[model samples]
Target: MTEQGDTHVKRKMPKGVRKGGTRFPRQTLGDSLAWAKKLVAKTHLGPQPEGVVLSGVVGNSNSVGRVRLSTLKQFGLMEGDSKGYIASDLAKRIEAAPTEERSALYRAAVLAPPVFKALFDTFHGDEVTHAKLKQRAAELKVHPEETGKCADVYVTSMVTAGLATLDGDKIAHLSAIDMGTPPPSPLITEQGDTDEPKVADDDGEGPEDETQPEAPNPKRAIFNVNVTLDSSLDTEKLERQLRLLKKFGAI
Candidate 1:
């Protein structure tokens, strides 16, 4: 008889609901794209011009213009150098793609950035909350307040890109994100008996020496950490504390 073991995963709850009322540097990728499109259309432009020209059009009063422009560049839909911003070939392809292909294109854009990619890979099959993501930013030494803002920005960007879904404070990675890797096919091949290859003549060879160099051992160090918690801590609180300990490399 064979027995199968079930695996249980621990999912962390994120804090704070993501409402449209919440302010961000860039509201969403869709909004930013719309802004860019409008700017181009109003100017009778056949293609996006350099960043400097666009900046001039934004005028001196709009400080948020630069941030929105940066967001556009981050999505890989637009690119810039010293020469300025222009429509990337990939961006053009995405724009021209059929409606059905647009979701994949959006996912591609979301995964283009390292930070967002890391977040998705880390929590792909696991449930995570916005608060946990913010805590992760804190663990990376990001400012507490900015962590919240950045979390919001990431969610907005990914959701707008169609690579993720956000409900309340929970973020779930959507299967729609096209990472460009295809799924493996499940087919089995049957092998029949085959003739063995004749070995070449060798001077009484036993087996090739397959030795690997030993790795050096480093000195081990240990430190103690102390924390206080309520006498009757619940599962959620206990998990959060344990996570904190793990963040400090204590466990």
Candidate 2:
């Protein structure tokens, strides 16, 4: 039962927990791609130890190093446990992915982290501002101090993902419609000439002199999509969502 701004957090703030700030900085995707490329090049030399890789590629084994590693992991660019760090599937793909697909890949990675995932899912089809998101973090019972930071992380990540845009003090969710998929093209069939039977004018005695060909029937592609409307989503948002679906080949 607390408030962060216009939004009211209906839950208590969690206590005594630290670690894991934002999933990625604004340029995290680009940095990850660059890092992955370097790592790939290094792998050609030999199987280097994790410490050597982290230290050599990044800076010292302190704040900067830790941040880089954490950000990479959040985007699924790197994978490792107690053993150490290694390139993840996403990392490899990113290295090989085309320039256009890079943004999508980056977004995918950013959303992979739990913090970003929860935030995106909770706000899907909803119009929320930065303050509201902070309030939401508070309602989720995150630490009071972490609320603003969490909100910032969410906003930055969303902006990078093209899911949200800044509007004055508020961060508005991009209309899903603008990003939604286009309607599927109708199937077309080319008609070919066919022989037709003729009837005798007299009592089925012989075939008629002139015969008429039957018209061809082309099958049209029918889309079966169930769309649930949300008051929070406007025409623009709906269009964005559709465009996104189209881009992802969901439609």
Candidate 3:
């Protein structure tokens, strides 16, 4: 199934409690945990652009730019050049389980980790700084308070269960993977080899093709275009050409 399909399936809660009731603590926790497990199962970790994951979760480049630097430090998911926090190992385990067992597995995983709450708190606080969250809450057709609460609980559950990590505020770390640097280009070696091609001299005794090309001229190029029009040209066409010339500063 698709990742979104898995998320939808995982988000489904048993029909025992009201839509937003704190009274059904067991059910809420169970549902959150179950959802977390499914998310973990579906996610993969690798070197993704900061923009990709952040775009998936957060809207607005301004919000993302504000949070990424601080969040990465707080989560310890990435260090220096190597970007970390793809997915947690727990997510993989839960995803491997049977469909029927996933809910319970998620529940257990979330409850097992203490850092989940901390991660949730960090992001929840960060999200409020952006106006887009409020806008998104309205668009989703839910009260902002309810949406915020759901986000908090859901993120916390995912983190606790090892399905997600706050690698950065804008992007969740899933799949417990690390990204490596790209390999060097093979074209570099080929170009180096071509640099020293031997050329036969007129005497057939010495190399003549080893020299490199001369440096390019640093002076800028100058060019002009001239258009000749008859004095009796159509007024409308002349006006349009004049306007174009004015726009290009060639009038």
TM-score of each: 0.52, 0.54, 0.24
Runs off by more than 4 Å, candidate 3: 1-45, 57-82, 112-251
For all candidates in order, the CA lDDT equals: 0.60, 0.64, 0.42
Best by TM-score: 2
TM-score-based ranking: 2, 1, 3
lDDT of 3: 0.42
**84, model 1: CA deviation in Å?**
2.9
Q: What's the CA error at residue 75 for candidate 2, in Å? A: 1.8
List ranges where model 2 is wrong by over 4 Å: 1-34, 44-48, 175-251
Model 1 Cα lDDT, one tens digit per residue, 1-251: 44555655675433332223322334466765565454443333434444553554443224456556556666665666535466655566665678898777777776665666666666654567999877765665555556787678778887787666788988876542344554323343334344444344675443476575543445755578777767699989899998998998887
User: What's the count of clashing pairs in each model shown?
Assistant: 5, 22, 7
Descending-lDDT candidate ranking: 2, 1, 3
lDDT comparing candidate 1 with the true structure: 0.60
- Clashing residue pairs in candidate 3 are 86-174, 87-174, 87-175, 87-176, 88-176, 109-161, 110-161
The candidate, 2 or 3, that scores higher on lDDT is 2
Worst lDDT run of 10 residues, candidate 3, spans 176-185
- Residue 54 of model 2 has an lDDT of 72
Clash pairs, candidate 1, are 14-129, 14-130, 15-131, 51-84, 51-85
In model 2, how many backbone clashes occur?
22
Candidate 3 differs from the real structure by a C-alpha RMSD in angstroms, to one decimal, of 24.7
Angstrom error of the Cα, residue 111, model 1: value is 1.6
